[model samples]
Target: MSKGVIVGIDIGSTKICAVAGIMDEVGKVKILDIVEEPTQRGRVSNGTVVNLEFTAKDIDRILNVLSDKAEINIHNVIVNISGENVEGKAHQSFLTRDDSRSTIRKEEIERLAVDIRKSFRPTAGNIIIHTFPQEFIVDRAHVPDNPIGRFGITLGGNFFLISTPNDPHLALRRTIESVGVKVQNNHRFVPLKIVHTLFTPLADAMAVLSEIDKKLGVAVVNIGGDTTEIAIFQESGLRHISVIPFAGKSITNDLVKAFQILPDHAEKLKLIMGAIPPDEVGKNDIIKIPGVEGLPDKEIVAQNVSIIIEERVKEIASMVMAEIMHSGYDGQLISGVVLTGGTSNIAMIKEVFTKVTNGMNIRVGNTIRNIGQTAVAKIADPKYATVVGLVLSGFMPLDERVPEEVIWGDIPESQVSIGSYNNGFDTPNSKLNGKKEEPPQEEEQSGGGIFGWFKKKVSSAGKIDMGDDKNYTN
Candidate 1:
């Protein structure tokens, strides 16, 4: 329970994980402990909170368990968030340097970089998360890196920008605030400060990808329960990113619809019994599944189930293939695809990807480099890559938008009212209250959710009652 210890909370579609650890002297993230709890399905879908109250409860439950295991009142933490709303696009930013300046001064280069960030105006209700300059052009020539001290009249940067809507971003912080770390001294609560907010795909890249693969051009496709994030990297930097709706959930739902089984059973059938290519399954095999209530046991052909799984897996891969092609790094990715997340553990998934991407040397990334706690080598497994990456922030902090320091957001670790207007969010803080807009739900996928987190009190007994969502309604 040292002051330097920072916790990482990863809220995903199917589960919530809280990890407490500190970087060891050897520059490795030492795992102190980890605690996980079910996300109760769609409470948090595609990494965005839908029912703020229920999501808060789930997060609070996990953190409380972590606080007890670590034997301390954990406070500040780094967070990873995602959603289908997360999108990235290639953009051009240019500046015409004046002749009077003579030389390209440091500030001039810096000004040009900031100006490009300003130029990217997302649609209303959206904000830029991070802007990465892929190449610096000086006088129509590409400047591999620093453009300073170089002589040029036209200074420009070709960038790939990442952005998401403000509503979900706000909802994430408010959800954290509502579940703020509980105090033990008295029956009171304080805002659980967020030290940093990161993109899930970026964090997964940090844990699952190596520098060599990056330089050789690699794609990270994290297939989680409700979403699959695609990140294409080359020259040791991000070139494009996207979040798609087809993922493990889509496959599970397909099984549910085709097999007439519950979600849990369908998921097990997918994981334990499913495989690529119907030929991998026996033609005459019969699998029996227990029926709900008092009905007779259901019988299904094994090859037919495998065929269904393979078809859905193909669907997910097709979408992923389209994204890689869209990135324009399609042919250049020598390292090919590095798949992460729970669904990546599927049998023969590599062959599926290899077939889809025309044999791109696909590999499943399951281990983290220089990771401590070797006894449980893959300490966190692929599912917790985001949180594990956060734990390694001491040494592997995310790269700044540019060489110069420009802090877009700095939310200090201080107590505040989650409900009242005095909350400490750097942005104008408020509960999206009466205007709980529900984003379009694709099939069963709703990218948007409710937000009514308040400065609810938690008793000294370590219990909180946030009450009903009706109280905050319009």
Candidate 2:
């Protein structure tokens, strides 16, 4: 495949975001442009395309804006899809070797994956979007991280399958195509293919998680406008994924009803004053809101705002904790939970999570630290996590990737082979000969003083450095 720019488009419930970037020789992502526009009501819901015409127009507008800003004609994009309709299931497939003593080969593994894919049968109105291998079991006795050269008569392992309802899937595809851009085609075993639909939480995990985090077990919670997505990883693989139907929108609705305020005003108030308990908000502080129509203005105590937000946040946190427990990896996640997405920016969110999880460690996940560029402040918001992760997904090496073979429209399984996996493992030139290649090492810069630590923190926070210039805040 030719190397060039990669674009990641996040069609979210609240907004649509597009990120354009290029992966450098050293595998660093350099931002070219970022654009976002609100998703008008009824256009999209819970990450699924509901109105093709409206969505297509919005997608076209963002793509055109992004193209103009980046000075390139964007044709394809890696999109993220999420919602309650999107589901995940766990399954294990076994393959017996012809020779009991023969060692497992790369082709054998590839064939096993293909067989597993072919065996899956989605519901009548659904199609599989992604299939991920969690681990490899050899002879039902030994579990090897990589079973390429392991000798075993029987080979089997756990796999996680993600599927979405067909109606939304087809609607999303038609919306993209309606804009006159060809969706990137998926090829068997191709590396870093650009055109695919990714699970939103999975994409968010890829963008914020480190190698250690994945190996030690971690849960990523992406709280979006209308839904909250959860992805669990352990041993460098996906273990569990789920979408909570309630999220930031739920909190906004709660605020709207609690304060008897307009929906728009409630959203604005939530963003401005939302916080968990012990957030240092003064009880006597009052916030005035313009009344609807000709009604008199209302004065609400800041403490009341915190109280309303705290209750909703606690409920959400409890739900997340319940999901973690249900995943059966509750105590196994040494890396704890990484909260991300737009709602993660809420004040004292980490505290709420910690309280709900019985003092489990929690950290806010952001992509700013992973990006290698100076002017990335615009995309530093956690709201851009999925899109940033989608861009980063295009830069991952083949072996470390998963198949993003989206079943387009209602196309027959024969048209797009059921076993057509594009994770780069089936390529003829693949070097999966029982040897792992070391990733390219980056040169380190030395800095350890107090000032250096402060500088590093500032950089991680996506702040621009201007020597001798006064800092400003928005």
Candidate 3:
């Protein structure tokens, strides 16, 4: 492990949460400590930084507590960027080669990525957050995967580029740097700031998704105070992302408008009453609200509250479903939807999503392989997933590759099962009825292909051990 400790700060409209975590010797993520602070009214709208000064102060307070608990100097944090200003669009780039016989190198592909950024600015003042590769085209033909070592005349790449307005991008950096968190790259001569800014939907995917889930396809629906973030992943890549303005705050506002109550009171009712489908609650059950200035208390039916909550929840769910379908990956999501954020915890909120999305496999988000099952409170809450992702950022890049079928495929039955005992044979499937073994053919009788005369040879003899470097073979 190059680095032991990582800190992630999740800056949301409702609150700011910081998490300090370390990858232990056994390779499990261990949460060191955590600290949280409210964003204060009007400082942040949704996930955007409206007031840089106060946002910096809120982050500073949280950093102070986390730094003390972790006993480490707090600088260089993994943070996220979000809000309506952020958007993603398709981008393509071509690296033309004069001679088709020239072999492509890794450096050339990296150069292509660097050169591609210059073309992403559709409008002025837009900064690219990420350039996710959708596919690589070699000589106008599809290659199996990343074609760094191939020979081709034209290398074209299809990408999904995420970008934000310069104002928000600069504001986010300024807020973090104001609180003493500066991102620096000393190993490389060129200064790089791209490594520090992770888009929110990608962070949500990192915290809750697994390799199979992403490879098979999955969607992350993050329901927050002021916005709902939806991201679709297919073939181990982020295919789409959408931010909806309707969220928990909308439900609170509806309650305030219908009952003529205070915003705080409405928020309280939404949280305590629980947002469930209207039919789940009985109509006769009523919760009395104490009126202000010694006025008469008002009686409110539980079913009415359910009705208001369910309506807004359904609208958000409908938009979420629409974004997934619009991505054109609706049928490919075998892992289905994984829900996160504070609003996702509402009672039976998933019930509404299931019904709206036509019964996809929707479940509340949890760390798939990012963290082990633990007693830490933050580990269990979906609200802290973004911060946890920030902490996990040090271990792996956003682009996680699925294993190729050719290199690692299914194995045959072992010795106990009377088929393939080891990798001594070259058959994809070696099956024999009962315990009898099949005799070798005429070609196998000759000492050819390194396996002399049907004799078995051990191609690999090693066990997987993370701590021992010699255990691995090339």
Cα lDDT, all candidates: 0.69, 0.71, 0.68
Give the per-residue lDDT of model 1 (tens digit) for 1-474: 224677888888877888887667876667777888877865886668788888788778788788777766777787886897776666666777877357776666556545555555454566666656666777778765656678877877666666678877877787786676766953667778876567787778777777788778998888898888888888766787877776888888888999899999888788776544455678898888899999888898888787777777777887788777766778999899988888887786788888988888898875556366532445547777777776655345454335413223222122122223222112434344454435543342323311110111111112212112212212
Candidate 1, TM-score vs. the true structure? Answer: 0.79
Worst 10 contiguous positions by lDDT, candidate 1: 451-460
- Residue pair clashes in candidate 1: none
TM-score list, all predictions: 0.79, 0.80, 0.77
Q: Please, what are the lDDT tens digits per residue for candidate 2 over residues 274-330?
A: 643445788688889997678999998888888878788888898788778876788
Stretches of candidate 3 off by over 4 Å are: 98-103, 181-195, 275-280, 373-375, 400-474
Off by over 4 Å in 1: 1-3, 96-110, 146-154, 183-189, 275-280, 373-380, 393-395, 400-474
lDDT of 3 by residue, 45-141 (tens): 9678788887777877777777666676655577878896677766666767766787876545554454454444433445555667666667767
Query: What ranking emerges by lDDT with the best candidate at the front?
Result: 2, 1, 3
Q: Is candidate 2 or candidate 3 better by lDDT?
A: 2
Residue pairs clashing in model 3 are none
